[model samples]
Target: MKKVLIISSTRNSNLDLSKDIKNYLMDKDELETEVIALEDFELPLYTPTLEEQFKSTESFPKNISKIKDLICSSDVMIWCSPEYNGGISPIVTNTIAWISRATDDWKEGFKDKHCLICTSSGGNGKNFIKGFEMQLKYLGSNVFDRSLIKTKAKNIEEFEFTSVLTDFYKNIFSE
Candidate 1:
């Protein structure tokens, strides 16, 4: 079975959203799903000084390397994040920054891999979703167009979001 890694880039209530996505994906027998909360991998803020240190040492921080490996190993990636200040949360960007620097071939970790971006936020999640897709595509991921968004009004009921996510997975698997 293909392995799918779902990355939740928020803490607290957003964790519930990520769990919902995991449970929905689990319903499918075709793919084995794992959920990784960004909070679990607490990385230091990236800096040029740190980059120089890692390069000179010829090794990345253990957590950063581990996350890069996880991203490379997975067949597909699902990102559930929140919008902060009209953009992706810092945690999400931080992880990406670390992963991009940790490897010789940054794009290799992401290139052509199936990717889906979703968000649960105060308002409609369009800004985060759109911003994230731009970055993901730039990194060479084959991003899916239909993204799942849960706004304050809807807030992602279990059944509706799950059904949409399941259908999205089915379509991706079919293709």
Candidate 2:
């Protein structure tokens, strides 16, 4: 079975959205899905000095290892975050920074993995989706072309959500 990791950058609406996606994928015979909220893991802000300190000790924080292991083991990742000031949230960026520094290969957690980006934002969220797509691609992920956007003013309808996920699943797992 393929491991599918759903990462939510917040404990709020985006986490709820991640759970909803996990629920949708739970019954799929070929997939084993798990959800994680970044808020649940307390990580210090990433900086060159902090990273160097950890590396000097020949280790990273336990939470960093836990998240990195999850990403490295997963075949597919569905990322859910809110747009903050027309860009990706700080937690998402910080998490990636730590993961990159913790791994021998910077892209170890993301390379060749299938990624589907989703957002539950107060804003339109287009900028966040587009920016994150580029970043994921840079890390060597096969990012889905379409994003699932759920803004506070306009929520995602059931049909649209299901259709996008169904298409993404087929495209990723087809024989």
Candidate 3:
């Protein structure tokens, strides 16, 4: 069975959201699902200096390898995060930076993988969805066009959530 990796950037609402998604997708006989909260990992901010230091010492954070392996082993990824300043949250970006740097190929974890961007944010989350979609596509992911957006003013309806996930599942696994 293929694996579905749900990455949550926060431990609060976003983590709850990731769990919901995992529960929804868990029954699929062809796939196994797991949820990971980025907050659980201790990753330093990515900088050329820090990268050099890690490279020189050959001691990148242990969590980086764990995350990279999860991403690389999975066939699909569901990204759950909150918008920060009309963009991707720092944790999501930081995780990606570490993963990219830790891998032999920068896109090793993302290339040819299927990804669905989701958010539970204070705002509408359009910028986050669009911006992260572009970044994931650049890294060689097949990003789903539709997203699951739950904002403070508007929660995702049950039917809509199911529909989006159904469509995304078909998109990734269609024969």
- CA lDDT for candidate 2: 0.93
Tens-digit lDDT track of model 2 for 68-147: 89889999999999999999999999999999987899999999999999999997799999999999999999999888
User: Which structure is stronger by lDDT: 1 or 2?
Assistant: 2
Q: What are the lDDT figures for the candidates, one per model?
A: 0.84, 0.93, 0.91
* Backbone clashes in model 3, listed as residue pairs: none
Q: For residue 108, give model 2's deviation from the true position in Å.
A: 0.8
Model 1 worst lDDT window (10 residues): 155-164
- Ten contiguous residues minimizing lDDT sum, candidate 2: 166-175
lDDT of 1 by residue, 62-148 (tens): 888889889989989988888999998999988888888777897877888889888888898788888999999999998988877
Against the true structure, whose lDDT is highest? 2
How much does candidate 3 score in TM-score?
Answer: 0.97
Model 1, runs deviating above 4 Å: 157-159
